[model samples]
Target: MEHANDITLTVNGTRVSRRVPARQHLVDFLRDELGLTGSHIGCEHGVCGACTVRVNGEIVRGCLMLAVQADGCTVDTIEGLSDAKELEALQKAFHERNALQCGFCTPGMLMAALDLTKKNTKVTREEIRAHISGNYCRCTGYQAIVDAIEEVVNGQG
Candidate 1:
């Protein structure tokens, strides 16, 4: 058996530590080990962005990263969207716009959207689509998602 390594990292503003197998995928470590199931596992090969999470302000597929690699990094998941009415603008906008369905890809999509918004406050529709190309929404066809992001980044929310 592979002996697990002790790992500690900050997640969603909380410090978390665990003994994980060397081969444990960061997705598993986050979801199963740490109970941060916001990072979903889809097409584990890194193609699908369903497992996306922000590490040090950059979107990274949890499935493609090792738990150990996040030793000293700060990670953010969909659960970090906001508290109460903090990100309410974006959350309410997304809900009203119907940006999600099935919700399997919601977390990753949000993380990517956050990245795009951070890249530039004036992000356009086409730009948002291109930014979230890695995240696939099997249900909604992406129109509402784009609208939600546009509304938020453009400060219409």
Candidate 2:
């Protein structure tokens, strides 16, 4: 029998409580339970960074974290960040730079970019690349994405 655990967590500024499977991934729980689909499931592993989300103010691989592990923690998805206007500049920069193609990786890319930008205001291109190395974008060849993030870091965006 599948075990279910009751969890209460804050998501996107809203308090939510639910009973989820013990093994359910945080991203799956967010998408299936709360209808927050901005974070896509890619690779189903931590390496792709496609399931990136903010947990307790830090970026984490949602797919690698169980929903029960997030109990009482604050979770922020792309939808929440966008709704809060926290990703406005990055979104605008990404759009203007044509940083995304298929868009499958945009949400995770944005999350990673936001984390890096928050930690460092003045960043080099190499540093930017290194920061986002975990996120894999099948399209765009990463050149435009790097440019967009660099622009945001340099205050040009």
Candidate 3:
């Protein structure tokens, strides 16, 4: 039998309570339990940013954090961001620039870009690259992705 821990948290502006397995990571809980599949599981080591999400308003790797650790915190996934219309410019820019090829890393890249742009939308291309360095995109080679993010940041989107 798997050990479970009861926890409560706010997810995408909704209050949620569940008995999660003690070993369950936040990504697993979000994907398996809450059915939020936008946050893809990549390396499972926090090295890749595929599972990036906002916990308590800070971007964090879902794979590195346990579910119970977020008991009283607010979790925001790509679904939430999309629903909030927070990623509209980035989405459009990504599409126009062909930043997403496989679409596997788009969510995480968007999440990371959200964090960066939230700080300063007028960021340089090198700054954008530095901010998104953690997110690994195997397809785009990053130039298109950088162009997309730069456009959005530079207010062209």
Candidate 4:
């Protein structure tokens, strides 16, 4: 067995320190070590965005990143997007518009949506589609998800 060592970093606004195996996936570190399961695991090969998380304020697939690589990085999962008091506007829009079907991909979808907003809130339909291309939803036929993103892109939410 490979021996692991301790590391410290900030996660979702909280200070955390722990020892993890060098080969451990960030997804496992977040979900198993830190107990933040919002970052789901679908296609572990990185084809699916289900394990997407923000690393140092940028979106990265957790399944594709090593925990040791994040030793000093700040990580934010879907759980970190909003406080318990209220939901993020995109979340509300998604919920109101029924953006999720099975919800296996909603976390990644939301992460991508948040990033898209940083570029510009007024995104074209095709742009929205392209932004979430990394994420795959098994349900909803995409119309509602697109509509929800449009609501946010159009600033209706």
TM-score for every candidate vs. truth?
0.91, 0.97, 0.96, 0.93
* Candidate 1 ranges with C-alpha deviation above 4 Å: 84-86
lDDT of 2 by residue, 109-134 (tens): 99999998887669988999999999
> Considering summed lDDT, which 10 consecutive residues are worst modelled in model 4?
80-89
Best by TM-score: 2
Cα lDDT listed for each candidate:
0.84, 0.94, 0.94, 0.86
Error of 2 at 16 (Å): 0.5
lDDT, candidate 1, equals 0.84
Measured with C-alpha atoms, the lDDT of residue 31 in candidate 4 is 94
Error of 1 at 147 (Å): 1.0
Score candidate 4 by lDDT.
0.86
In candidate 3, position 128 carries an lDDT of 90
**TM-score (C-alpha) between model 1 and the true structure:** 0.91
Which residues of candidate 2, in runs, are more than 4 Å off? Answer: none
Q: What is the Cα-based lDDT of residue 32 in candidate 1? A: 88
What is the model-wide C-alpha lDDT for candidate 3?
A: 0.94
Find the 10 residues in a row with the least total lDDT in model 2. 116-125
